[model samples]
Target: MGAAWETSRRTVLRGGVALAALAATAGTAFAKPAGRRLPFLLDMVQNNPGEPLFSSRFNDPATLKSYGYDGQVINEFIPPQTAITFDSFDQRIFPAGSEGRAWVEAAAKKIDAHIARAHAAGIAAYIFTDIIVLPKRLVELYGEQILDSKGRISFDRPLTQQIHRLMLSEICARFPGLDGIVVRTGETYVQNVPFHTGNNPITNGAASHLTLLGILRDEMCVRANKRVFYRTWSTGSDKLTSDPDFYRQVTDQVETHEKLVFSIKHTEKDFWRTIPFNRTIGVGKHRQIIEVECQREYEGKGAFPNYVIDGVVNGFEEFRTPSRTGPIGLAEVVDNPIIAGIWTWSRGGGWRGPYLQNELWCDLNTWVIARWTRDTSLGEEGAFTEYATTRLGLRGEQVRRFRRLALLSAAAVLRGHYSVVHPMGRLMWTRDQFLGGSDKDLTSDYAAIVAKGRVEPVLAEKALAARMWDEIVALSGTIPLRDHADRTYLRVSARYGQSWHRVVHHGWEVMLRGYAGDQNGRYDKAAMRYHLARYDAEWQRWQRLAKTEPSCATLYQPYSFGPKGPDGLYNADPDHGIKPATDHYRKLLSS
Candidate 1:
């Protein structure tokens, strides 16, 4: 249950990230300013320094100012689930009652202090909450009214509407300086009540509930003179593969409110690469923020530079157009602003971080997106150089070398490991799950895909990254004299990437061999053993770094993949699963 508790957690790549061909063919010229540069919003974890969201460093004015972000989506401090568990979180749970009123007053004082700190840092803070289901207490108090004839939860209920109105109104009224509230209608992890189960009352038909919630939130926000950001991430009813109508209905219904903005991923789908721009972008009259996950979960999290430069640039271009506008009409594109801000998840969306103090790579990527959002014309190379020089104190050849290695690190993962078959498919666990066949089938005819002639570039990229990593690691001792502690981070990060790449590469090799063996009615035990042992050795090697490098252990949770118990390699703890895998391989070798 240790790491396995997280097994149910899906390691998400920013879902549905579309790499617009417009960006590829549109030339890499930095965007010419079109009206106002989009504001950059950072997503911070709630409740101070901890797993998945906030680090105490996030509260510092200097830290907030350093990223050049305009605001924050401070998530989960008052999440519905957490709020219901505590009586003191009365403002969030039931702000209308006498106890709640007292609680609200007390909470507001504390809330104001943080909001003041944020405002002093020149950052507007928004409370981020998710309410897929009514809290357990709320359900008990108003279950009959909230639940429809089928025992399904309904947001249209008088009680349901009242609770939302009360919760949002109290927060907004109490903390007038707070910028706004941002919420997701789809995808909330509350206990064991499953989402997207089709028949689940709370989640099914979520678009309508979201619209109802959105309107209530907007009405309260207007009174409080704050913003309401309704994220169009999912509806729990339809997959993006064929659910444009659901998205359309949700956006169309909610976008009517003037103060409310729809926060959308750049692509219509959840975060992933190779996905093209979501058609929903320029649609509807409501302004939307292009949500970018700089701590990319799919492409090495922040272990490598999985740059979405094209995605950011394309977002700027598409928002200024009528081609992909929604039913709200093309005229709205000109009169009403389209993109409101660039929402970025600098850290924590996946199991990636408690990160090191000197996480230059993630910080650099965050800087790139933040600066780029402000000025599309910002040159990636120049941005990196300036950041390296100023932030890292890296100059001359040191900067150049860092840049080269960083670029190659990304190339290595994107080209060499990121699935070409699935095109920006999540490579975290099931590396190429979308591949047309099992490993044996693909390996048997791997030549066919290779014949398409894509493998060469990937190999070349891998070679380049390996070479760069070796060179960079070799210079660690000398680099500290001038480059300082930054060298150690780079070395650890590079080694982590290389180790990860090796495990993935060799894991595939083992699969191909095993599957091919089954096909041939023979097991190549030696090759199988070799690949498994190599995989284990590489993982153990990194485990040693995890022991020494505080961030490596804290930030990069080995629980996702390491020596693990018996299970198919579907995001299981490798540490527990590896022994069984080895024993099976040995037995098969004898057979």
Candidate 2:
């Protein structure tokens, strides 16, 4: 790998300009209303779900400016799963041998152009480091000794480690204009790996792998005068507890590096509701950034607006120093204080694609984050009103009604549905965990119980789903959407919401016999017929909706690996939504 160009006179002048720009924003970045002037880094990753990759609008400098992102990490640049594979268009920095030299060099030139544009717009450019584990090519080229029998990364071997260093150093050397790298060791997203295998250095521990990689990245970045961001994602065995002491120990080990910054999600878990603040922020001594996902990828798949004004505001509040008088923002008051910035994910995490189909919700939410981080005194309600009025062009009453709908939707998803869901039972609503007992077993168990007699709890869950769906339908009708696309999203969402309840209702019906046991002498014929009919009708509706609104499938049911099942008409569960329904059919037929 090589730098794209020699230091020319234009390059020198550009560097001077960049430095001056940094100096100009230094005070604002540091003070941020509360008043201490440390560097406030607001980095955003370009992973908006359903967003067309490499599209003109997405790559335009003006569009980046509109979002108010200080720095942008171009995601999937390294092709996380198939890094070793060669794609003519995909940007890759690995496979540094001569085989990849020309391709890497060509990609470098393109990357340099992007970096220059980003810098021109006053936005730092960084590539997301997705070296979850050794790709199949590396293991095959070197030897099988790279991994153990269980496919766990075997750190005892030196081959993979050598390749890892080569990849990191090559990428840094080649992309000299890049601000730094963002490392995610927890979620490799490598295909067929059961999703969360936590691939890293498996010998010492998860923490060891994280530190070693951080040290390597730091050395490379320090030499190149770049920065390295190590995310405290707690992937693999590096599972952290609520105890601050545990994070303290981990932070003590890695935070000592000067150029390395620790990035953590606002909550301990993957951008989910009800997850408490990650106390680790209170323990770190180095520069840190709190990662917030603007699009509700899984919670609602961006079909409807899922407001998180409270969640984001609460997160900053948790980290503020106690007893701070006057307008205290994060900068002014911090107890264990070296927090330097905020990292927000606009899209591209989870099983789905982009969060907002209409772009209204996405743009507003991203704007709120960028503005609020700069001025913590800005009240959430005031911010929403300003956004609705200014950005959305909504008047007084329209603004209030819009706000009401957003909050109500949030409550329905987070409190109404998510709260009642058994922790292990995700109902295909989450991407952070594998589909297991709570997802697959519960439905069958309920069917068995229903066989004997009606179960009060199952019936109650069904009613709750129906109520939520009805409320969603009612609210959707009241909100006026002029845009055809926006209106289409509402229609599909109402239908999907309704279908979800039916899925649950039918699932409960199918599980009845299992719970009834010996008392299942008589089969309830009517319930079975009604369940099948409802199930078929929902799928048929999805088909019709897909034809009318092509983006509906991706917008409504975007999964990690594309829209699941035929025409994106699958049930909410995994392996296609129809599996559970069909499995129930077999059970009923035999009976």
What is the C-alpha lDDT profile of model 1 across 65-137, one tens digit per residue? 7777778776533442233323333334454654644543454555566678888888787767565444455
Q: Write the per-residue lDDT of candidate 2 for residues 364-384, one digit (tens) a residue.
A: 566676666555555455566
lDDT of each: 0.51, 0.52
Error of 2 at 106 (Å): 3.6
Taking all chains together, each candidate's TM-score versus the true structure is 0.72, 0.71
Q: Where does model 1 exceed 4 Å of error?
A: 1-36, 46-56, 80-110, 132-135, 149-152, 190-210, 239-246, 254-258, 303-337, 352-357, 415-417, 421-483, 522-526, 549-551, 554-583
Determine the C-alpha RMSD for candidate 1 after optimal superposition of all C-alphas.
9.4
